[model samples]
Structure formats: C-alpha cells, structure tokens
Target: MGNQPSVPQPGTPLQVIGAGLSRTGTASFSEALRILLHGPVYHGGTQLTLAASSEIRPLMDIVSRFPPQNASEKKLIGNLLKQRLDGYAAVTDAPFNGLIEELVEAYPNAMVICTTRDAESWVKSMKSIQNAVTMGFLRFILFPIPGMRHFPDFVDLMRKQWWYLYEAGEPLVAETYYKHIDYLKRVVPEDRLAFVDVKGGWGPLCKALGKEVPRDVEFPRINDSQAIDRLAKRMVQEGLKRWSIGFATVGVVLMSYVFWK
Candidate 1:
C-alpha cells in the first residue's frame, strides 16, 4: 500500500456490495437495493459526484495510484473505503465493479450481488447509453469549461477504472464482463454471493438478501438511454446559460471601462 490512508474499524451498517458493471441494470438494482435494505444505496452518479468533491478528492487520487490487477491493491482500497464510506448501506456500478474484491474484504460478511446480462445485450445497452454523439459533445464542449470540467474528469477516471474508455471493440467489453463475473465467483464465498440477472426480477434478489418481496411495488428500471441523453442535453444547456451570463458580465465591464476612460 503506497501512502495508504489509515484504516477505520469495520462496521456492519453497510451490508450489501453490488459487483455489477454498468449497462447491466445497475441503476435498477441500486433502487431495488435501497428499497430492500431500507437505506441509501450508492450508484455511479453518486460515486462520480463524491470523487469530484474537494473533501473526497483523495478517493480518485488513491484510485490512480493502484494498478487494478494487483491483488494487494484490494486490501489497500478496502482500508480507504473504511474511512470514505462509513454510512452507506450498499454500493453499485463503476467503481465498485472495479474494486469488488477489495470491498468484499472490507465488508467480509456483506452480501455480494453480481448482476449480469447476455453479452450481446450488455454490449447493445452500453452502446446505447454511451453514444458517440452525446459523449463527444460533453467531452469536447462542456468538459473544457472551468466549472464543468471536474465532473467529466471524474467520469473519465471511472471509465478507465472499469476498462470502458479505450477497448478495441464490443467483444472486449463482453470479455471484461464475463471476466468480472468469474472473478466474483472465485473471490466471494457461495453463501455470501448472489449471481443474478435483472430480467429474473425480485425473486433471486429478494431470496439472496433474505428480504420480503414487496407485492405492491414493481421493480425499478431506470437510466435508460433516452433518459441519459435528455440529462446530457439539459446539462449542456445549463452550462451554456452560465457561460452566456459570464460573457455578458465581462462585456458590460469592458464597455463601462472604455466609456469612463
């Protein structure tokens, strides 16, 4: 562990660790976990926002310091989480997928949920949400600006951690997906791990977690491609609005100075 932070005492409040990749119904699983556990569940957006915050900036720094393939890196990451995420009941998506082994070590008794889908379907889902047009627009336009830059940077780091940023093709992503699943199988004990498909719905999940399946509420399915696209467009519009205001203020100041002179 290089310059490792102090490890806090293990706590039992965080009882679930989702070792699922994105585009594998992580968004849905996150919501369901929250409901099942009756507590907050951390997702990719949450992780990204946390990574960008000044207080939690060290999380990303620590991530950059470790090579993903290093076995001891998991222990180091587990120690870091002991300090960083004390109150969360569960976690899902990008960063967790990358650090499943570490998290399992951190919360040894926590239930590990490995949600997966068919490789072809997973690839399709990833391509749908990570469309070139939307991602390129954000990467080129909003991310270059001062205030908006941190978020994209954080997301980029997460993508790199998940091996999503620069793979040769879809097959690589599919391969990584299966690799993660296999890794989970190897690391997590049989009783502690639950391998599931989102299409299987609440039965497997509820059974795994030993939670009562709510009869009235349907399972959640969130963060679809259309929803993500809309969110990106909204963010871009907001960035433009702020930039326009800044430009107008500068123009007014320049005009006032010239007139007075």
Candidate 2:
C-alpha cells in the first residue's frame, strides 16, 4: 500500500477521528460517537469552555502549528497532539476539522467520520456562532473579565481555522464550505472515510464502522448556534466569581482594621 496510515497499537484509547468543520452537525456527531463508542468524546467547543489557563497555553501552541510544514514537522505535530489527546475516544469540532489529514495518520486505526450538511446552511450557522462570541458587546463584556485573557489566542486560532479552508481574498462562505468538504474527501481514504449527514441518522455511519445501529436511541440533534454564548457566559461567570472572592477577602480585612481603630 502507498503510505497507508500506521496501525494503531492494540487497545488504543482513541478510535474515532472526526474530519468535519463545526456547525456541520459536529455536536450531534460527537454525542452519537460518545454513545456508539461508549467513551468520552473530546469536543472542541465544550472543551474550550472548560479549559483553564494551563490547558489553553499549551493547546494554543499545538493548534497554531497545523497543516505542518514537512514530513518531519508533521510527525512532530502528530506526537505533540497524541500526547495530549490520546486518552479520548473521539475528537471533533472546530480545530480537529482543520487538522484532519494529520490526525488520520496520527491515530491510524481510528475510523474517520466526515460530517456533512447543506453548504449555505453551514455558512450561515458558522457566521451566527462567530458573531455571537466575537461581535457586539460580548467582546467588550468578555475582555474585561480575567478568565478571558487568552481571548486573543482564541482569535488567532479562529483566523488560522478560517484560512485552513478559506482565504481573505476569496472570502466566499458557501464556496469555503464546499472546499472544506472536498478537502476531507480527498485527504482521507475511501475505505476509512464515512460521510455522515446527521439527518441520515445512524445507518450509514454504523455500517462504516461495522457498528450495530443503536436500538431505541435516536441519533442526536444539537443546535449549536448558541454554543458560543454558553461558552462565553461560563468564562465570564467564572472570572467574576474568582474576582468576588478576592474582593470579599479585601473587604473583610479592611473592616477588621476599621473595628480596631
């Protein structure tokens, strides 16, 4: 075979590789994989929501090195990612879609599932989520919070994600959507790839993985347009909560001095 992906070691923890962009049913896709694989799935949106400074610092560096420069570089990037993510049963959403080719080689035995949807709808969905988190008062409100100090790093990652399937000059949303799907289909091998539209439900995906259709379990349908709002709110609330703890401590100390006087 011509440079087939290396066989994963026996009992490799990660088994599902998602080669799809966010807003392409990725949330629902992640849930279905969690159910089917019977293990926790690493979702980019949710993971980022819960990430602290320590996690983001390293992950930011790792994600920024995508579409690796050469074979040696690709190998280095793959090792770095697997070191961090090898424990998860599946990896999906935003940046994973951006790193499909490298992930396939890194996690060789993992079945690749490329989530699909209407291109125009995908474009609109992406825009709504981006605008929710980055535009309007959300940015101003979010930036003042201490927890969102890594916000600039997130913006950098987003820009990199966009250029992975897009260019500033072209900037055609629908066209970019198609290009991403086409890139996935081209990059992943036919035998290893499954094109999944969550609308089609479980049959095609199950067949690709040699899995039984889950009984009494309808395929998941998650509306992720508001996912960013939830992520942002959590960050802000957490920051303010920590700030309040410090403020309260200071107040108690000042009151003690006043009472002594």
Best candidate per lDDT, number?
Answer: 2
- Taking all chains together, the TM-score of candidate 1 against the true structure is 0.80
lDDT of 2 by residue, 113-180 (tens): 88888988877776666665554444544554543566666766767766765662223478887777
lDDT of each: 0.67, 0.72
Candidate 1 overall Cα lDDT vs. reference?
A: 0.67
Error of 2 at 218 (Å): 2.7
lDDT of 1 by residue, 81-194 (tens): 766667667877766677776788888879999888898778777775556333655654565345345656655566566553233243346676676777788778888988
Off by over 4 Å in 2: 1-12, 51-53, 136-147, 168-172, 237-261
lDDT of 2 at 108: 80
In model 1, the runs with Cα more than 4 Å from the true position are 1-12, 46-58, 68-74, 132-140, 143-148, 163-172
Q: What is the lDDT of residue 19 in candidate 2?
A: 80
Candidate 2 has which clashing residue pairs, if any? none
TM-score of each: 0.80, 0.80
